[model samples]
Target: MAKMPVYLTTPIYYVNDRPHIGHAYTSLATDVLARFKRLDGHEVFFLTGTDEHGQKVEKAAKDAGEDPQAFTDRVSQAFRELTATMGFSNDDFIRTTEPRHKAACVALWQALAGKGEIYLGDYEGWYAVRDEAFYGPDELTERDGVKYAPSGAPVEWVREPSYFFRLSKWLPELLRRYDLPEGHPDRIDIQPESRRNEVRAFIQQGLKDFAERPEKLDLSVSRTSFTWGVKVPGDEAHVMYVWLDALTNYITAAGYPDTAHPRWRFWPADVHFVGKDIVRFHTIYWPAFLMAAGLPVPRRVFAHGWWTNEGQKISKSLGNVIDPVALVEEFGLDPVRYFLLREVPFGNDGDFSRKALVHRLNGELADALGNLANRTLSLIQRNCEGRLPAEAVRDASDAALFASLDTLLATVRNQLDQQQFHLALESVFASVRDANGYITQQAPWALKKTDLVRMAAVLRHLHTALRAYATVLQPFMPATMAALLDQLGVPADARDFGALATPLPEGTPLPPPAPLFRKLDLPA
Candidate 1:
């Protein structure tokens, strides 16, 4: 059977704020999936970029005394720099203001308008400029002597002339479409039935039309009033709304408005990874726009939860924000990747604590996996004269070891396919722990002098096992695995899952090995 094409995306980070751990988390998750899909033999397309146009960005640019474009360009480069530092292999980096993206957005807007799906009207509602969101009064709540939306954005009343999408018409269809049979790709992140029923009941009671407004509202302002967004096709009176402009990037990155391009084949995205805070924009408004334009809806919108630091929300004032680059430089990238994935279950809120990070890194990464590699390679160096042994007969111990690897690989592959990355990493580490125990029990060292030939064979098998182990770890720990493979003398391109269960020849000279991880000390 032909392998299915897998397209993955991380929600583009807004460039108004400096890159943070939250941005890193989303991109890393997408990178993990892209690597896994490629290893699974799928043609994968991965995309990540910065969302550069919005009111927040305009305000930020004004505060910095720079053009919004110039401000975004600098910050966007910072985000791009992160991909290389974090070892990401995204296929493309798209920005909202690019000519191709602007054309695509204009075309999509025209498509939706031509279909009688958009109508100009007066829009009066509570708009949160900070959130770049428009909200209904019912969704407002008092907090700290001020009204705020659930997303923590302050809301204010406003009335403006806006173009409205016929969202109310599709409420039933949206709910029904998500009501597909179990095991469907989209069913993975469908709202709970109770919540769905509540939404449905609310819609049944009465549904309101949704108006799309430009990032900067028009108030007979001069042409130079707002200079931060895509020009509104022919009408210079307005620029595209940030939500509309940002959302079109998914298609724009894939050669939108040009079906001749190869990426157009995957135009309707397979999955969108977004924070739950924007679920309404992704699940509700995005689909409505696509449907209005006679375009296919995205397959799924999986909303992941946010992270807090040490039980408190990460805030600049609180000084609890986690800097991803700082963490990567200090702990090394792989350990940070391993801890973040293994420390929390996907789709759930997680706390980033130095203690939790240290415990996992020390216990799982350093003690379990790092020690296992060090011990095995040290044995081979001392006993086998630093050479891998030839494959030997299927002894009971060897058979058991191979059997365990087969099972673990199977489970790891399955968990990765399901996006249960924590479970997948756990499964692989469990195998490492087991391998460590097996080595200690077999005491390959004890047989070194008395049974030197058998020792050679055993060390050879262990060396081969480590190669396989490192291959499985490449996605989550690319730098470390590359180093591990270098020590094993495996060719650079030979470090994939397919090389498992195959042993390099005996007498293959091994490179000098170094410690994969160092025990980190807590700062005083």
Candidate 2:
């Protein structure tokens, strides 16, 4: 059978700090989708890595008295390790500092130049190195006696000789493309209705390609200033702008600008998952760049909201940033993963709290799903000789469970396709809740004493139900699901969705059972 090609990516993390809950959330979501697609027999290509070159890294390196390349190497390794620790199965990790990445960046720049999209120009504008973006006067706000970007990054005025892309020239084209349907190749995530109106308003006020000098602009190919980034193709004096250089990492990871490369099928990324803070850059500038280079724009750019700690924005400077590794270690990996995806609705802002985490682990995991597994397995061990029993026929309660499973599976696939991860998880929990209720009503334990045949039928139904649940959850809680399947004596890889009713033999000896979850202890 020919499989569908599926490509997924997380915004490469900036190597300024170690991974956090925000990073973990995004990567975990991508991993779930990747695993699900692969199980469904898709030709999956998943890519993730560090954004190694930026002004922040340059300054951090200077402060530490190390070359930028060496500094980035250490930081990038830390980001790479996150995939393994979190159980990610990424196929490629491309750092912007790689020679191949540099080549792709240079090639993309030349491609744009060949199309007369780039030109030499001097720029004098407000540059926010922290955000790696230039802001016009209108976008700046005065706060606490300092100018800041809308996302609160500090800004500074600068005048420099640089090459410029004719961004203004593409405005009409961008708007036209943005109006296309959701999955169009030319449709990049353009500005939102309000934001698009704002951009149009700015253009109506008279757009200017160069903020300071237009007539006597001294634009050149190279600059002698930085050795940390990709050099301009013909002139080594200038390096590509960080924004220009950073965006190319998306395709560079897929072996872009090289059609013959083995991993090239993953180009035209299926989705770009980014935080809301960088929506404008990803949605506007990135698509424009691709269009200029005559490359296909990505299918979608889904911008999710940010997380605040205890109702306030998380910041290391303020000492409120939550450590994801600490949370995972303290309350197991699946609990943290489940809480983050379930607590927040995708694409909306949310707050994180220790109290909420404990509530979810205890209320949902320990009390609901964990108890469901314990009761089902415990009954099987006592009545069915610690072995699976064959089911002859399903009764009313069993029929209800089967019906619910059908709904759950359908809804889960729907939610995931829409990037509504939390909604998908809710469907899983709904099945858990329903199955638990069905077990309670059927009373398999009670039937074993009087009617052995009825008890066998009930055990068979429970085993089939639990097996289906575990299969559905394999992409989300892989470790726990594997443990559950191990107790059932089924191999991990054999638990894919369609194999739900394949049935264990009539008398298969079960492995030792273990608690699927430990309840979190709430502090006084």
Candidate 3:
């Protein structure tokens, strides 16, 4: 059967802030999904980029004493550079300021206007410029006679002429699409069931207002107060609201307006991986905008939680934000990636601490996985020549060691499908633990002294186990796993899931083994 194309995206991050752990976490998760899809033989397009336009960008440009375009260019490049710095394989990095995005946003505005879903209106509400969102009075917290958003950003009353979308008009349709027949081909999937329920409850309460009449909120889609965004179509005085323009980046990546463009083949994204704070935007506002433009909504919007540092909220004020680049520099990129996903459940908030990272590095990656590979390769080189030895199944103990590799591929594939990255990795490293223990009991080195036949059989089984381990671990620890696979003498193209099913050819010449993960010797 032909594999269906898998299209996934991370929210285009705000350029006003430097890329940090939150940014890295989302992109890393998205990268893992994309890599797994490619390994599973699916056509994949992974989109990530900067949300470069907003009142915030304008202010930031002024603060930097640079042109808005120059400011956006510098900051957006930081985000684009993050993909390389973090070892991500994202296919496209889009900026809202790009001409392609501008055209796409304009096309969407025209579509909504032509459908009579847009209207000129005055927006009178508290706006959180940090979030690029308008919030109702109830959503704000009163403290010290000041109002702050749930995210703790200060909010201010802003009344301006804006373009509004009839967002509430599509609520019923959004609700209808929420629950379809199980496994229905066209059904939209929202992951982590908790988020879907939350959004559903919010919309249902709003629907009570519509129970008296069709609900229409006149959503502000454009703002006259900002000059950094795409100009509202035919209304040069106003710029498109950052949310509308940023959300349109998804369709822009899909070749919107130019619907015939080949890039449009990946329309209606398979998933939009976003932070929990923005679930309302990606799930509610984004879909309503698409529906207004007569376009298909994305299939899934999976919201993930945040990261805290030592039980404190990750904040610029506290100087507690974790810099992913620094983490990669201090530790190997692959180890940091492995630790983040492995340390926490995918949907839950994670805590970052130097101690925890080092523990996982030394324990999980270094001891369990890294030591096992190094030990096996060293024994094979020392005991049985430098080439892989043919096995003779003379002892029951020889086969017990390779048993862990038997169901690993299927187990990992199902976990990845469910987005249980930590579980998937835990399963692999669990086998690694078992393999380490198995080797200790079998004592391949001792077997060499007594029975060379059993020793060769044990070594071959060890090599086979490592091959499976390396192949499945590629998505999480690509660089380290690639080096490990290289040491195992597996050919480049053949390093994939299919190769996992096949046995490593006996007598394959192996490269000298080296430590896969180095221990961190932190200073006291």
Candidate 4:
């Protein structure tokens, strides 16, 4: 049988800066969805990459005594390396400067221009090079004799010839899509209820028609102030705006210019995972661009909140940025991955602290889950001569514990579909806690002395429960789950979602038990 296709994407990271925890958070969220869908038997295309071209890169290169492309290559490679260091399974990494991407961007621009949705124009506004965004007079603040954006990036006055998209023409259609019934094919969902309302509110604020002075609302589609981007199709006098170039990365990766290419079949991406700060870009501008080009706006745009270090916003100036590399090195990748997803709800802001991470690692992972695996394997080895029981001999207590796990696969599947990562993990931990309590109360050791058959049954139940827990946790904590499965004598081939429902073969010889999540000793 053919599997369904699921296309997932993360916002391309801007190489104007180094990758940080916020970048990791977005990739981690997308990676979880990709892994879950693949395990669920879907053919998945997961894309993540770098937005490497901009005036920022050119100036940064000039400052650093390097060419613009060379500087971008260095920073983009750093972003790619972060994916491997953070243990992500992204299928492809793209750069805006890539030749294929340049062709794709030019193709998209020509299509929109051909449709009469774009026109050459002039723009004058307060621009933030760092943000690559324009602001109105009221939008800038005078900070100690300098005008700055709300985000603190410095703004400069610019008047230049440019290209503008006919954004307002489709405003009514965009608004109506939001009002569609849930799951309607044409409905484009903006997730986390609050963000959907936020985007709608921003749209209602005001949209400048092309007939108007063309100031506050019409987006400048091509920037004449900068040439470090994809060139406009016939008029190479200006470059396509950086955001447009960056956004086209999604279609470019899906083989846009070659519309009939196999990868395009995964279009109308199932979801686009983005940070809350950029919700407006994903929900508004990107969708408008796609609709104008006659492409599908992604099915859903989910914007997740940021992380702060102990109540203060993470910033390079603050010197308080969480080093993803250090976090994984200090604590193993699985524990770090588990902490990021489990510490907070999927869409809310989270605060990271050393104390909190160590607590989750030692208390929940080491004590609860890892302990379950170690104790279960140890019991079977010592009591059953290193061979699993022929079959699980069930009692009311054993059956009850197993029953808690009966709905787990379905529950996690639902949670992933909704992108509720924390809840999905929380549900898995519920069974882990249940198994812990069952083992303590059943007293398998006491049964060993009093009733040999009952003792074997109790150990078997514990073993089965641990295997189930490991199976569902694979998407979140890949390394830890693989280690747990190895200790349980489960073969690599039998460690998939389908195999989770099958019982372990009787008398399977297990390797000696080892701790899957060793207790961490983080300094206070």
Candidate 5:
């Protein structure tokens, strides 16, 4: 069968700071999806990198007494290092400062300008430099003689010669696109039903408000106060808005301007994974920009929620920002990866607790799955002389266990397709728990003394189920699963979805069993 192409992306992370656990959360989720698609026989393109150009970046660079390019180059490398550190399987890592990306941004600007969707205007509003967004007066809150954006980022009044995109003109089209029913072919699928509702509400409100006051709906798409970003196509005095440049990185990595570029086939990306805070830029401004440029909009945009450290908001002042590298260094990479997705539903805010991490590490990884694998393999090694046991006449219990294994992949596929990582992991581990129960009831060890034939059949059943578990789980915990598969004597080529249909050959020699996970010591 020909491979189906699927494109997935992690929002290009801002380069103003080192990578944190939140960045890892999004990248790991995207990585797991890409790995799953590849193992399931699809051609996948996974893109992630740093968003390098913006007023905030320039200010941070100045604070450090470094040139903006040098500053971005240094911080961007940290993000690149992170992909490796986390074992991310991205096909491309694109930096906004790359020449191709800058060119693509320029072309997109020209396309919108040629369509007369862009025009010169004076931008007078309350802007939040920290957010790189504008807030209407009604959205601002006052405290102690200070004004703050809805995000609590302080705002400053600004007036500048800027370019504006005819955002209000496309409000009706955006509403139509977002309002398409759930199963509509061209529906703009914004995930976590709550987020989809939020986008819908914003659009409906914008349309209602636009009829009363149209000027307030247009978007400022260029800035005169920042010189560290993509320059306007014809107006060097202004730079494209940080968002315009940043969002274009999605298409730039897919060969935007050169539609004939081989990788351009991946355009109109299958999904763009972003944090909830930026959903407006993606679901609203991004699609409108694509429409103005006569380009295809992405099929879906999933906005996942934030993470807090020990029930407190993660902040620099709080000094509780979770460093992903440190977490992986303290706990194994796969454990951290597994804990992040398994601990919470993908779209809900979750707390990063050491107690929770240790509990999952000890209970799920070490006790449940690992103990099952070790016990089953050790029994075969000791009784069957380190060989895979041959199957005997099956029983009703055997039939029931295989029934669940048969449907495992389909069940996981449904959950993952909707970005439900927690549910998918739950499904996989549910089988693990079942297998554990099967072994306890069968007592294969005691059966070895009385009914050798039944013992062999019981061992073979477990081996078959373990192969299925490891095959499906390789995406979430690659290194650990690879080791597990190796211990089972599974050929490296036989690790994909296709191999699940062909069980391990009976009597094949297996390696000595080794424990996959060690119980973590609890903190005092």
Candidate 6:
């Protein structure tokens, strides 16, 4: 049977700054989903990259006394290094500065123009360089005679010859496509019920009002002030707006403008993972662009929340930015990965603290899961001659435990499909805690001499249960789980979701156990 195709993406991080925790969070979430799909027998195409063209990058380059291309190349490499540093498995890394990406953007612009969805015009409005977006008068807040965007970024009035996308023309069609009742098959799914309602309300109210207001303006899709972006197809003086170029990266990575590209089969991404701050762009503007170009919008846009640093907003001025690489170096990679998704619900804001991270590492990873695997494998090595226990009849307790393992894959599948990562990890650990309790209650150590046969039966059951846990956890903690599976005497080929149905052969030789995670000491 042909494998099903699954495409996933993380919003390209801007190249004006170094990679930060916020960037890592979204990419990590997307990586987890991509890894899970692959393990479940799907052919997945996962993409991530840098957005190197924008007014911000140009200004940042001038400030540093370097050419824009040189500056972007330096910073974009930092982001690319992050993928390797954090163990991301993205199949491709795209850059707006790349030739292929430029071609795709040009192709998209020509298509929209051919459809009469874009036209040359003079743009006069309040624009925010920090956001690379235009704001209407109503959307700006004034304080002390200065104007700021809804995002709190200060704005400036600008007038230039630009190309405008006929966004107002598509407002009704966008509403019809995205404003439907939840669960409609054709609706553009924007996740986290709160965000879904937010997008829906914006389309029904905010966009409607913006379109019908006296100006009756369309969206500005080109900029003449900065020479840092892709140029409009036939207009050399005007560069395509940074957002337009940035958003086209999704299809570009999937081989856009060349539908015959084998990878093009993964078009219409399964999901796009973006930070909450940019949900408006991904859910609204990107869809409108694709619709105007007659291309399919992504199936879903999941906007995840931000992380605070020790209960304070993460900011450069505050100097509280959390560096993901530093965290991974201090704590092992998998433990850091585990704490991130486990510490909070997927779509809600979270606080990152050294105290919280340490507690989860010492308490959850070392105590709950690591200890369970350590003790179970240790007992099997010492008592069962470093091999899986021989076949033994099961009791009611063993039957109940196996039943839970039987349904675990389906349970995790459902949770992940909804992108409930925290819930999925919770379900996995629930079984881990149960296994811990079972080990304590069964007292296989005590039964070693009195009832050797029953002890073997108990050990066999636990061995099977541990395999199930490791298989599902491979996506979240790939390295640690791979090591765990290696120690279980499981074959390399027998580790995917499909292999969960087959138990390890009885009396298979198993290697001696090693502790997977060490308990961390609280800082003095």
What would the TM-scores of all predictions be? Answer: 0.91, 0.92, 0.96, 0.97, 0.98, 0.97
Candidate 1 collision pairs: none
Residues 1-524, candidate 5: write the lDDT tens digits: 78869999999999999999999999999999999999999999999999999899999999999999999999999999999999999999999999999999999999999999999989998999999999978789999988999999999999999999999888788878887987675667888889989988987787786687775789999999979999997789999999999999999998989999989998888889999999999999999999999998888999999999989999999999999999999998999999999998999999999899999989988898999999999999999999998756677977667777779999999999999999999999888888988999999999998998889889988998888899899999999999999989899999999878887788889898888987888877
Residue-level lDDT of model 2, residues 159-187, one tens digit each, is: 77788787666666766776778656566
lDDT score, candidate 1: 0.77
Query: Mind giving the per-residue lDDT tens digits that candidate 1 earns over 1-524?
Result: 86778788899889988888888888888898889778767788899998998778999989999988889899999999999888899999998878898899899878877887666666666778788877666778987877888687898777765666667666666777667786664442344233345444544444433224232221111122355777665566667778888988998988888878899776567668777677667776677677777777787666667799989998999998899999989888888988888888877789998888888888888888888888888888887778787787757777756666767767878887666789998878777777777788778889875887777767776776777778888889888888888988787666666666456766888866798888887644
Q: Report residue 173 deviation for candidate 4 (angstroms).
A: 1.5
lDDT of 3 by residue, 1-524 (tens): 87888889999999886899999999999999899889878899999999989899899999999999999899888888889988899999898888999999899989999999998878888998888888767678988998999888899999888878898788877787778765664455677799889888878877875577653455788888867889987889999888899999999998888889887888889889999998988888888898878898888888888999978998888998888998899998998899889889988888888888889999888888889999999998887678998845546765555566788888888898788899999889888887888889989899888988878888787888888889888989999999999999899988878666666677889989999999997435
lDDT of 5 at 150: 92
Residue 59, model 5, lDDT: 98
Please give the CA lDDT of all the candidate structures.
0.77, 0.78, 0.86, 0.88, 0.92, 0.89
Off by over 4 Å in 4: 207-216
Clashes of each: 0, 5, 0, 0, 0, 0
Best-to-worst ranking by TM-score: 5, 6, 4, 3, 2, 1
Give residue 347's error in model 1 in angstroms. 1.3
Query: After aligning candidate 6 to the native by TM-score, how far in Å is the CA of 418 from where it should be?
Result: 0.7
- Candidate 1: stretches off by over 4 Å: 143-145, 182-227, 398-400
- For model 5 the local lDDT of residue 174 reads 81
Q: lDDT (0-100) at residue 57 of candidate 2?
A: 75
lDDT of 6: 0.89
Candidate 2: give the clashing pairs.
Answer: 121-219, 222-237, 222-238, 223-237, 223-238
- Per-residue CA lDDT of model 4 for 81-194, tens digit only, reads 999998899888999999999999999998999999888889988999888888767668996899999778999999999999887877768889987999899998999999
- Over the stretch 1-524, how does candidate 6's per-residue lDDT look in tens digits? 97879999999999888999999999999999999999999999999999999899999999999999999999999999999988899999999999999999999999999999898889999999999988878889999999999989999999999888877766667668766776665578888879978877766676657644623547889988989889887788999999999999999988899999998999889899999889988988898899888888888999999999989999999999999999999998999898999999999999998888899889878898888888999999899899899767778877656666778889999999999999999988888888888999899999997999999999888888889999999999999999999999989999999988877788799999898997788865
Which ten-residue region of model 1 has the weakest summed lDDT? 215-224
Highest-TM-score candidate: 5
Model 2 ranges off by over 4 Å:
183-185, 189-227
RMSD of candidate 1 to the truth, in angstroms, is: 4.1
